[model samples]
Structure formats: structure tokens, C-alpha cells
Target: MKYFGTDGIRGEYGGEHVNEAFFEGLGAAVSAHLQGKIKGRLPKIAIAGDTRFSSEPLKAAFCKGLRGVEVADFGVVPTPALAFGVLKEKADFGVMITASHNPYTDNGIKFFDENARKASDEAQEQIEKFFDEKISGSGAEASVKKVDMKSHYIAKMGSILPKGCLKGLKIALDCANGATAGISGEVLRGYGAEVVEIGISPDGKNINCNIGSEHPEALARLVKDSGAFIGLAHDGDGDRLVVCDENANKIAGECVMGLIAIEASRQNALKGGAIVTTIQSNVGMDESLKKRGVEVFRSGVGDRLVMRLMLEKGCEIGGENSGHYIFMDISPCGDGLAAAVKLLSTLLCLKIKVSEMSGVVSLYPSIQKALKVARKTPISETPTLSKTVEKIEREMSGNGRVLIRYSGTENKIRLLVEGKDSALNEKSMAELVKSVENDLQ
Candidate 1:
């Protein structure tokens, strides 16, 4: 909690905690950590970022902190690209600068290990501890050089997708005016799809502004109006994905995972016959997979936690409901463009539409509410709320579920209720919300 969150160290750009001085310290900490791992050799660190105006300055400060380290500055690339480059270059690690789907006013910094995995909790803690220490560089001025990784990345993807797999498919894409602006379209075109791109232009201020996976309704409208066969929208950092059918009906991330599972099963590619998801995922996904004899594993929320379970369970796929997906067989981190290509390939191979394929999972009606609270108290310490939640669970029994937890980034408590009956779910949610408010607000 000192410097990281469910995602990363995110705050308002230019704020006290997220400004130049902080990132400079963070950079030095990262350099020292990686240096310790390599035992005094020059550590190589790759960095990339989204299109936010603050990204460049923060990145500069971070690199300046790494005066003695070898920096591969992948200018203005997606978060996944940085992860991929880290592994491809055999660097010690990498960093991504962007607040993901958060508003443009915010920014963040996250690291990936040499294997492209999220930095472990222990590693993050070490970085925080070192932030206060003054570490000398290599006695030379910092010089961050740019690297181009798009061609190599696209070629790797090309090998996985069948030749001309997307031929004649009119695909619509919403790049969210962020990292994937020009990158995603080129990949789809290379696969032989007629790409209809929106949110392709970024003015450094409009990333995810009423666009991207957080607001797929806009892309759905574009899909319907443009008469495209399918639509894909990505969050600002190009790590999340949301899709729409030809009719423009949006498909939830879990539903899309279900569709992928079916294909993987048919091809005997579903390792361990298991899938991993977060507790936030709809229980309907579990029920739907049960019929196919596929086991479901739940981890704490966050893509990092989801991947942890996947690695332990030997599953080939895992993701969150927020559209952050990991096809572990392809990449360690989430890549929205990779997910889009896989979906397209599956459709071609199955000769089915997105609407029909997505129907593989039937979900119960659910409601999610994030209530702003003045403070965050441990749920165990809030007796009133705990008792109320227990009573609600007893009443629901086999009919529904209740999950309440605090947000890591903000002073908010997220409440989710899913049930066989919408009215019952709503009633239970209201009671839980009030209980939480009374105890924490």
C-alpha cells in the first residue's frame, strides 16, 4: 500500500505523490532492486507508456533516476508492448506509465519481472523501502534511447493466427485514443480484415474519454452503424478488451472467456481442463463451464492474482471481468490486440457469429455499486456490517451471493449481489450498502 495498489502507484498527474520527484525516487529504487538481482552488472530496463500528456515528463524523471542502468525507452507504446519487449530483449525488467482506464488527469507506474510477470508484493515492498535511499549512478549522465518493437510484436502474432484468417471480415476497432491508436489497426489489416477504426486520434487529453472498454456502448453504436461483423474496444493502456456482436450487443469479458474456452476444449488445448477468474466474476460463468466438465478457480481480484492461480493450476487462460485478459499460452501479460485476433480466428474456424458464440455462457442478473466512504476500516473490525452480511447470506442460501470489499485505489466500498431473482438481489444489495455506509461512512 505504500506505493502500489491493485494495479500500480496511481494518482493525479503532477500531484504530490505522482510528480517528478516521486518517480525519480521510484526509478532509483527500481534500478537498485534490479542491480541487486544481477549482482552489479548493468541492468537493462524497458519502459513504455500511453498517450497522456504527463507520460513523457514522468518517464523522463524515472529514466533520469536510472542513470547507471541500461534503458530501452519504447516511446509511446502500449503496456503489453513494454512487457513483451522486456522478455524479448531479455532485459532485467520493464515499466509501464499510464493509469490504464482511469481518466487522463491520472497516471501510474508498474513493473514487470524478467518473465514479464507483475512484480511480486515482496519486490514492490523492497522498491518502496529503497525509495528514501540515495544511490549513486554510473557517474555518467542518463541517456534514454527509443526502441521500435511494433514489427516484431506483430510478426509474433501473425504466426499464431492462420494466414488470411480474417479475410473479408469487416471488423470495427476502438483504440481509445491511447496506446493502440495506430498499432491495432495495422495488425488487423495484415490479417486480411477490413478494419474500421475509431478513437484513432489522441490529443494527449482524450484517452478513454467516453471511449474504450469502459464505455463500449459507443463502439457498439459504431459497429451497428458501420455494419461491421464485430467490434473490439480496448482500455487506454491496451491491456483490456470489450467486444460487440454484429448486431452491436456488447459481450462481457467473462462471456468472451467462455467462448474461448469452448474453442480451446474442442482443440484439446485447455490445459488441465481448468480456467481461472477473480471473485468479481459472475457465478454464471462457473455454471456454464460445469456442463462441459471444465473446473473454475477463483483468486483475489486483479489480473496479477488471476495469473498467479493460472500458473499454479496449469491453466492456459485467465482474466478479470474488467476486460483484462491473459492468454498465458501467448503472452504473460494482457494484450487487447492479441485477444481480438484470437476471437476473430475462433469465429472463422467455428463459422459462428459473436452473438451465437457468446451465448455459451448464461449469466444471472447482477448489480455492482461502488459507494464513496470517508474512510476504510477493516471488514473484520466492522461488526455491524459483518453481521448484516452474514444474515443476508443466510437468507439468500442457495439463491444468491454477496461480495463486499474496499477499493485499493480510492475510498470506496464495492458491493456486488447476484441472484436468481433481480428483485431479491436488489433488496439484498440495498441492505448491504446501508450497513456498509452506517459502519464506514
Candidate 2:
């Protein structure tokens, strides 16, 4: 927990833990931990990275720490591609050098087991233990091989939908100038859709800057101008997505997930007749899915937790409101391209306009805010904030909810107030924010 966050180990590049020295040590630590798990042969690791300038150097440092291991370098690919490569190669583990939606100034490491699932908390703890020890290598250099994982990943994505399912349709895309730059556009065009793209040019420094899922204003404009049927925006490392309809209206992730859940349920394709989502997801989605006889399971706020709950419930699909959707039938990890393909296929089958898809769920009025703090104080320890939250819940009288928690990845607090009355929700949120700020101060 000291190094790992909600998703992975991330921080500003060149920071204490994100620098080359730490990465080299981490590489050695990971290698050491895997040694005990494998049998005869040496451990193997599949590695890939996004388009950040720091990615290459960081990767080299990580590779240096591996002793007597086979390393496959998939080179500047999306995080999901690295996961896929791990499964295809049957490697002991995989590593992706990225910070996802973070700016180019930040970088991080994500680990996957041979099954292509994100490294669980237990696995990370074992690795951290090894990281604390200065273990010497056997002096046998790591055998590094450069593999072409993009072609295989592209082929897999292109095969998801029926051939030419997107024929004559125009699709707008924003790749965030990161991992999906070349790949997403190529896959969409191959599906017979006329693809218009932006944020596809990665200059290393420009990734996630005023573009991507985190910034969909530009993509919305593009969708309107191009007359595209829908607009898909992917974050820096291509694991997250944001969507907009032809009219340039942005669609919430909850609505997107509801639409997919309903369609999958109708086709009897939804495993366990359920989907796993996070607590952060809107209650409207849960209510809508319930009406259609599809159960919604809520987990903590992370794709890894969502996936874990999905496995527990025997569900085939799970996702977060942040646009990280997982389809166990396709890939263990969230894939933006894969999610986009699923959404398109669902819309095509339903024969509904993207704009009209919003009717699938009617979201309650909500006000959300994030406040940066010098430190993360536990909400339970903050009497003022706790009292304010309880009072707000009592006033709402079960018609709404209040959520307050510190971000697992950043030094900040996130607050959410949702209710039937928009005015009450807004007022309650302001009071909550004031209480949180005062407590922290």
C-alpha cells in the first residue's frame, strides 16, 4: 500500500519512487517474487508502454533489474495489449509503463498475472516485501526480445463485431495522443466505418493535454462537425473511454453500461444475469438494469475491484463510471477499443441513434467535487465532516445519498451528493465541501 495506489504505482515522473533507480529495484523485486512461483525454467515477463518520453528510459531500467529472465518488449502499446501479450506468450507476468489518464509528466507501473488480470493486493504486497530487500542477481543477463503485439491485438479487436457492421457510418475518435493513436483508428476503419480522428499525434509531451476522455470537449466538437454517428475518446494508456453522440452530447458512462447490460440480458448473453460496477456509478443505472431483470453488483472504486466482484458473482461484464469496462469473454483487463466495439455492436443491433440511447437510464440530480489537500485525513476521524454527512442523509430521507472518501491514488478528497431535488443536492454538496475543507485545515 505504500507504493501501490488504487490501480498501480504512479507518481510524477522523476519523483522519488518513479525514477529510474526505483524502477530498477522494482524490476529486481518482481523478478525475485516470481522465482518462487515458477518451476524449472526461468521466469518470463511481457512488457509494454505508452507514448510518454519517459516510458522508454523507465522500461530500460526495469529490464536491467531482471536477471536470468526472458523479457518480451511489446514496445509502445496500450496497457491492454500488454495484458493480451502476457496471455499469448504464457509469460509468468506482465508490466505496463503508463499513468493512464494522468498528464505526460506522470508515469506508473501496472502488473498482470499470466491470466492477464491486474496484480491483486496480495501479489503486490509480496513484491513490496522483496522491494525492501536488496537482492543481488545471478549475473545472467535478461534475454530481451522485441515482439509485434499490435497486429495480434488489432486483429482481435477487429473480429469482435460482425464484418462491416459499421459500414457507411462515420465514427469520430480522440486517442489522447497516447497508446491508441494508430491502433484504434485502424481498427474502426477496418470495420468499414469512416473514421475521423484527433489527438492521434503523440509528441511524447502532449499526451492527455486538452484531449482524450479526460477532455471530451474537443471530441464533442469533432463529432458534430464530422457528422459522425458517435464519438469515442480514449485516455492516455487506452484503458478508459468517454463517448458522445452525433449531436455532440456527451453520454455518461452509467448510461453506456446500462444500454449494454440491457441488450446482453435480452440476448441471454449476460452471465449470472448480472453486471458488476462500482459504488461511484449512478443509482439510476442500477434501477434501470433491475427493471430489465439484470442484477447490478457494486464494488469499490476501481476496475480491479469490479473485476474481482464480477468473478465472485460469475458475471461476464463489469466496469467503473470512469469508462473502464471489462468483458471477461474478450479480455480480463479493461480495453477501451473493446468497450467501444461492444457499444457500437449493441447500438447497431438495437437500431437506435446514439443520442436516443440516453433513455436507457434516468439519472438523479448529482453534484460531485474533488478537493486537493496537503494530506488525506480519514473521513471517520473528521467529526465535522461526519456530522454534516449524517445530517444531509437524514434530510434527504432515503431519496438521495452522500458519499465522501479520499482518493486512493491522489492526495485529495472526493465528495458526491445525489438526490431527486437538484436544488437540495446542490446546497447539500456546498455544505459538505465546506465541512471537509474546514476539517482538513
Candidate 3:
């Protein structure tokens, strides 16, 4: 927990845990942990990174820590591609250097097991234990080789949609100047769509700067101005997606998920007749899916938990409101490009506009806010905050909901209030925010 966050180990570049020296030690620790798992032969690791300037140095330092391992270096690929590479190359594990949607000034690392799944909590805890012990290398150098993972990834993604499925569509794509900058454009173009691209040029420092999924105003404008059928924006590491309609309206992530679920149900392909989402997802999506006889299950925030629940429930699809969509049938991890292709395929088959698809779910009015905290006191231990939440829930009279939790990756508390009345939701959120601040103080 000291180094890992909600998704992985992330912080400002050059900070205590993000710097090269610590990465070198982390690499050694990871290697030590793997050595205990694999009995014979050197474990092979597939490593990739995003566009952050510091990623290269950190990757080198980590690679140096591996003792007698074979390294398949897939330079400048998306996080999901590195996971796919892990399976394609039959590697024992995968490592990706990225800070996901974070700014260029930050970077981090994520680990995937041979199953192409995020390292389990148990695996991460063992690695952390090794890191604390300052594990040293066995003095055997890693055999490094450059692998063409991009070509394989592109081929697989491009094949997701039927040939010529996008023959007449004009699609606007913003890659956040990150890992998907080069790859996503190619796949869409190959499918016969005319692609309008921005945020595709990465200068290392420009990634996620006023572009990408985190900031999608530019993509919306591009969709309207270019007369594009739709717009797709990806986060720095290409594990998240944000879509805009032809009218330049950003479709909510929940609506997108609902649209996909409806289509899958129509085709009798929705596994277990269910889908999984995070607690942060709007209740409207659940209502919409329920009308179509599809069940919705909620999990804690984070795609890792969502995926776990999906497996448990035998669901093939799951996502977060923040744009992480996991298609268990395609890949174990969330993949922005794969999600885009799946949605496009649905659109083409249904012959509906992106805006029309969004209309499938009507979201309830909600207000969400995040407040910086001096400390992360457990919410259960904060009596005042707990009482306020209970009071607000009672006031909503089962017509609304309240969710409050500390951010897993930052020193902040996130709060949300959802109800039928927008005005009441706003008032309740203000009161809740005030309560949180007072309790923290």
C-alpha cells in the first residue's frame, strides 16, 4: 500500500517512489517475487510505456533490476496492449509504465499476471513485502529484446469491427497525446473510416494537456466542426474512453455502457443476462437495463474490482463511470480502443446515431464533488459525517442516493448525491460537503 495506489504505483515524476532508483528497487522486488512462483527457466516479462518523458528512464532502471529474466520491450504502447503482449508472448508477467490520465509531470507502474489480468491484491502485497526488504538482484543481467507488439495489437483491434463497417463514417479521435496516439488512428482508418485526429502528437510533456478524456471540450468542438459522426477521446494510457455525439454533446459513460448492454442483449450475447459497474455509476443505467430484463451489479470504484465481480457473476462486460470499459470476451483489462470498436460495431449494426444511442438511458440529476483533506480518517469513524449521510438519505426517501468515500489514489474525499430533483440534489450536496469539511477539521 505504501507504493501502490488504486490502480498502480503513481506519483509526480522524480518523487520518492516515481524516480528511477526506487523503480530499480521495485523491479528487483518484482523479480524476486516471480522467482518464487516460476520453478525453472528465467521468467519472461513484457514491458511497455506511455508518452511521459520519465517513463523511459524508469523502465530502464526497472529492467536493470531483473536478474536473469527475458525482457520483451514494446516501446510506447498502451497499457492494454502490454497486457495483450503478455499473453501473446507467453510471458510470465507484464509491466507498464504510465500514470494513466494523470498529467505529464506524473508517472507510475502497473503489473499484470500471465492471465493478462491486473496483479491481484495478494500478488501486490507480496511484492510490497519484498520491496520493504530492499531485495537485491542476483547479479544476472536481463536479456532484452524489442518486440513489435503494436502491430499485433493493431491487427487484433482493427479486426474487431467487420471489414468496411465504417466505410462512410467520419470519426474524430483524440488520443491525449499518449499511448493510443499512433495506434488507434491506424486501426480506425483501416476499418474505412475517415479519421480526424488531434492530441496525436506527443512531445512527452504535452500528453493529457487540455486534451484527451480528462478534458474533452476540444473533441466536442472537433466533432461539431468537422461534421464527424462521433468523437472518441482516450486517456494518457489508453485504458479509458470518452465519446461525443455528432451534435458535440459528450455522452455520459453510463449511457455508453447502457447502449452496449442493450445491443448485446438484443443479440443474445450478454452473458448471464447481466453487467457490472461501479458504485459511482448512475442508477438510471440500472433502471434502463432492468427494463430490458438485464441485471446490473455494483462494485467499489476501480476497474479491477469491476472485473472481479464480472467474473464472479459470469458477466462479459463491465465499466466505470470514469470511462473504463472492460469487455471480458476480448481482454481481461479495460481497453479504450476495444470499447470504441465495440460501440462502433453496435452503432453500425443498429443503424443509429451516437446521440440516439445515448437516449437509451436517462440519467438522474446528480452532484459530485471532491474536497482535499488534511488526513484520510476512516469514514466509519467520523460520527458527524455518518449522521449527516443518514439524514440526507432519509430526506431523499428512497428516491435518491448518497455515496461518500476517500479517493484511493489521492488525499481527498469524494462525495455524490443523486435524486429526481436537480435543485434538491444540489442543496443536499452542499450540506454534505460542509459536513465532510467540518468532520475532517
Candidate 4:
């Protein structure tokens, strides 16, 4: 009886959880769950992955499970391309092998629906159930085969580029040398930009070593030196994008939200004139959108939540401070390449400069720290942490915010604080985190 985490199956790169046996079950279960519908036609599946070493094995295992099911293997592809392929080929579903921005040692599987959105909770449960009871005993004869992931993905992304000219734009792109190294540069070319692409070469080991959304300082420095209009960085799976403006100043994800929301609203793409983000977003972002007469909607931190609110409110654009932007106008799931294109297009049309929007959302000075703790520890499960957090929230009322949550994939408790006063928030955060750690230990 294997347990599935919040998203999908995940664990160490080569850990027991992601082994061949699990893959075979996962494949067969997913296939069987979808078999009833496929009776009307051949069930089509698409698969892609980041540069993680576990990619091939997992892909192989998944394919093995889909014994009679048809699958198109888009090798070493990004998350967005997997969605594009599914919708382009009109397949039943798509699977992506990635841990997003997690360290290289960790990996995961992301599922996308037939409409190119992240899979729903019900679907995820079904997949896990299948993994719990695998159908095939032998994966060697699995009928899954390979397809040209690059060519199809490129064409699909290219079709979405805004019809215009980016002739004067000089952009530096850091692909994290993971999944996006291939599509980002070529697609920007289709839009007529002068693109200087770095980290496009993936060695499988350097997926997000020191680049991408998790760290854009390097990209910012390069953008300043290169004198490009903007520097774009993506996480390992290509689901999130962080930007650096012309002056080499890093633009946080939430700020980009204000920028994209403003432009989308101006362009009449902001349906219901609303933008969605997690509760952890900067106060400046919500305030900025309100000033522009657009609504700021709050959701849980997961992209799944942001997407749900987007669909519910029909929001044209929504994203996270983590750099994952889910543009409902494009697709339900976050697409780093799509966000890049949309942002670049909007900036070009505005003609003011990326630096201008830099001042749009002023993030509250905040800090997030985590300590490795046992998943079964009292601190995480005990009511004491919640009680302390509530007290902190009340004490810092109208001054700061506090958030405590367990990582869906890791054995750690995260402490997050955001406030208008940096010093106060910093001290408060430190004191609280330390107390929790000490008590738990």
C-alpha cells in the first residue's frame, strides 16, 4: 500500500519510491482508468521530462504500464511543451517528469489534462490508485515508443507568439540548462528578438545548480552587463519564469504579476478584470492592481489553487511569487515560455521599458526559512506550532504576516514572514522559528 503525496508520486532521484515497479503500476493504473473512455478510440498519451537522470527510467516504467495504450515520448521536454503536445495531437493526457525547481536529487511526475491544464484532484487520485495496484508484471514488452518532442513542441509554441516585431529588443535568457534550453531561444527568434541564450546546454547534473527562478542574481548581473531589455530565467521544468529588467534589477514574480495584469487589463484580456495569486503574495501587488481598477484574488500557494480561481473567475492572467504564471488565456498550467512571450509582447507594446514596471509592485521585505525535521515530529503534527503561529499573526496584525506549512514533498517545516517593516519582521520571524525548532527538537 504505497502512499501518494499531494501532487503526484515523488522521491529521491533514484529512490525506492520512483523505482521500476512503481512506474509499471503507475502506467497500468493510469491506462486502465482511462481505458473505459478509450474504448471509443485509441487512448493517446504524451510524455516529457527535465534533464534528471530518473527521467528515462520513469518514462520507461510509465510506458511499460500502458501496454496497449498509444504514447508519444517527447524526450527531455519542458512542462509547457508537454501540454502543447497533448492539445496539439488531441491526446487523452500528458505526463511530465520534473520536480520543478527542486534540487537535482529530487524528482516528480506532473499530470496535465486533455485540455492542457494541470490534472484535477480526482484524476490524481486515480493515478495513485493505479500505482498502488499495478496491472502488468513485466514492463519489457510495453508498447510505449518515442516521438520527436522538439519539432512538435517548437511549432506549437511558435504558433502562439504575438504577431509583431521585436527587432530592437535584446534579451538574455537563462534556461536553467534543464528543460527550456531548447524551445525558449528558437521561439523568441520567431518573434524577431535578438536573443543571447545561456544555460541552454543541459548536462543532466546542472539542471538548476545555480540558475533559474530559484536564483536570478546571476541572470540579473548578466542582464546589466549585456544591456539587454530583460533577462528571463526559468526553473528546471520550465513552469516558472523570473525576469531581470534593462538595468539588471531583478523583478520578483509577484511584481511581474502586477505588470502582466496591468498590460492584460489594458489590452482587454483580463476577464472579470481579476488576477490570482497565493496568500503569500506581496501586499504591494494587491494594492497596485486595486489602484488600476483590477481585482486581486487570493488562493492557496499551489498552482492548482490559482488555476481553480482563474477558471472560476475567468481570470485572463494569474501567477505566483515563485515565478509560476498560469495564463488562462494561454493554458491552465503555468508556462514559462508562454509567460516570457506574453510579457515581452506587452512590454514592447507599452514602449515605456521594463524598468518602468519595476516600480509598479514594491514587495514587502520578507524572509522564508526552513529547518529539516522529522515528518512524524511533534512540531509538525502537534498543535503547538499552530498556536504559536496564531499568536504571531495576532501580535503582528496589520504589520506583518506569518505562514507555516509542511512541504508536500520534503521532511521540513517552512517558516514564512512578510511585513511592511523589515527589521520587525526579521526579528519576529527569527524568534518564532527558533522557538518552534527548539521546542520540537
Q: Looking at candidate 1, what is the lDDT of residue 15?
A: 85
How do the residues 270-364 of candidate 1 rate in per-residue lDDT, one tens digit apiece?
A: 89898899999999999998898888899999888998899999998888887888998788988888788778877877888888865688888
lDDT score for candidate 1 against the true structure: 0.86
Backbone collision tally, model 4: 0
Candidate 4 clashes between residue pairs 3 or more apart in a chain or in different chains? none
lDDT of 3 at 197: 96
TM-score, every prediction: 0.96, 0.98, 0.97, 0.92
Task: Rank candidates by lDDT, best first.
Answer: 3, 2, 1, 4
- TM-score order, best first, reads 2, 3, 1, 4
Best by TM-score: 2
**Per-model C-alpha lDDT, please?**
0.86, 0.91, 0.91, 0.78
| Pairs with backbone N, CA or C atoms under 3 Å apart (clashes), candidate 3 | none
What ranges in model 2 sit over 4 Å off? 136-139
Give RMSD (Å) of candidate 4 vs. truth.
2.6
